[model samples]
Target: MFNVELTSERIARERLETRRKREAERQERIFKEKVRTIGVDVKALDMQVEEKKARKGAYVLLKADAEDRRYNFEACVHQNRQKKKSREMEKALVNYRHQHQMPSTRREFDLNDPDCYRKLDPGDAQMMLPGLAGEEQDSKSRLKRQKEQLREWLLCQQKELRQGKLRKKRVIKGMMAHSSMPWTWCLVCVPARTGESPPRACNRSFSSRSTRSRRRR
Candidate 1:
């Protein structure tokens, strides 16, 4: 009877050990499944982060390029403006020099001529000073005098043409000088140069005359 009791206890202990091993295996399987699921989610999240970083880097590169292009455009425009201004200044300088330096007449002096600077003989004396020739002199003397005067006038005109500066003269206030050009030319140009209207004194005289005529009538 004792033997039978011992055998029954050993059987019961073996069944209990088997049940504990099965329970441990089931718990381990559940833990491993949960860990695998968490690893998959982490990998997907890492992919999303890397993609966002790549997009941000691309945007930064594009923005830098745009700024570079804008800077280049502004620099190009400034250079063009400076170039145009320089060209205009150069043109104006050329025009100013041309107008001042050029002679009006085609006549030129020959410095190499032997007779150009010789002492005055009778013919040269006649050319230099013709009024010295007497009134009793014949038509030849008169013609020589006229020719000398014409040469002097031409010389003055030539001097006026090159290195054109107004002659320094003492100013005489309250004095009217004669103009070489016609009065009609002066009448047209005076208003334009001096920015003045025609003489109001003449207008006043005319108005006074008109009023007097009306009273007489």
Candidate 2:
């Protein structure tokens, strides 16, 4: 009688173990389906994000380039004005020298002799044109500031490029994860999807042939 009871208990335990395995396998299948769906969704989301970022960066770069060009043009204009002003100053000094019989260069003029300063008419002497001088200095300062801003924008562009590349990589990796190619997706999703895995093509540890063999088995 005891032997029969023991046999019945062993059979019951075996049945329970089989039921547990079936339940676990069912859960695994559901999980794999969810993973595949999520992988495709993630890939789509990444692509959209990358495109948006690229568009934003392109506009920013265009504005930065325009500003850089504007600064360069202003600098050139100021440089030309500076040359014209120096020439005018030289001609004025020459005329003053001829009228007063004073030396041409400042080094030749005697600062101790009040006669040298008297040669240039105090009331009529035009000091530097305030408007022109101010404009020239303002242009130079603006050019310097714009150049610095351009450098910063260039660095930002570089960073955007890197981010764009990284996002592309993420999209590719997601594609590989969902691929149906043998050994490609299987290896990638294996540790993540053990039993009842999806038909993803992974390139994990195994070779193509071996991964296919495991899939068949």
Candidate 3:
């Protein structure tokens, strides 16, 4: 029984020792620099980088495809607009030619007609007289208008001349009036004697004499 007990104890101690060794190994794996260093997982980071690069490449391709589609759409719209404009221009040209470019409306048709003189009525001969009577009437009217305009121009020139003469007369009259006015005299009294005061008066002749004397000096 003692040997059996000893064997059991030994077995339990061996299990405990094995468990302690495994715990120590686990701690070493968690705390050691080689196993738990201060750095990211290179494989995980590389995979993330590759994923980001793939996403960026896909975006670039999608953007380029969208731009190409947009350009093609705009080009197709522009082509359709141009085609419509060309069709409208062609239609307008065809309409214009049909309306105004008929052969009968052309001057050459009259010259080329074989019965050009035979188609004239009795009054048509007078109508084809090169409009000399109308030209004479227009000349008479033009001469009358020219005479009337010349009369009006002469009247206007005479009126302007009269106004200029009146303005000149007024200017000359103003100048003569200004020159004929009495001269202004400023009297500066001499310092009086201690007991005498002098009278102040308008002294035009005295001022004139003083002005002449200053001029002579």
Tens digits of per-residue lDDT, candidate 2, 1-217, equal 4545688899999999999999988778777865434335777889999999999999999999999999999999999999999999999999988887655445745766667556778797776765654456567889999999999999999999997677656655764665565434432343332324444443344555675578899
Relative to the unseen true structure, what is the C-alpha lDDT of residue 141 in candidate 2, on a scale of 0 to 100? 87
Ranking of all predicted structures according to lDDT, beginning with the best and ending with the worst: 3, 2, 1
Candidate ranking under TM-score, highest first, comes to 3, 1, 2
When 1 and 2 are scored with lDDT, the better candidate is: 2
Of candidates 3 and 2, the better by lDDT: 3
* After superposition, candidate 3 runs with Cα above 4 Å error: 1-40, 109-217
Q: lDDT of each structure?
A: 0.63, 0.73, 0.74
| C-alpha RMSD values across all candidates | 23.9, 53.9, 16.9
Worst 10 contiguous positions by lDDT, candidate 2: 186-195
Clashes of 3: 0
Task: Score every model by TM-score.
Answer: 0.31, 0.29, 0.34
Candidate 1 lDDT, tens digit per residue, 45-157?
89999999999999999999999999999999999999999999999999987887554322563444456557447665644455564545477988899999999999999
Alpha carbon deviation, residue 72, candidate 1 (Å): 1.0
lDDT of 3: 0.74
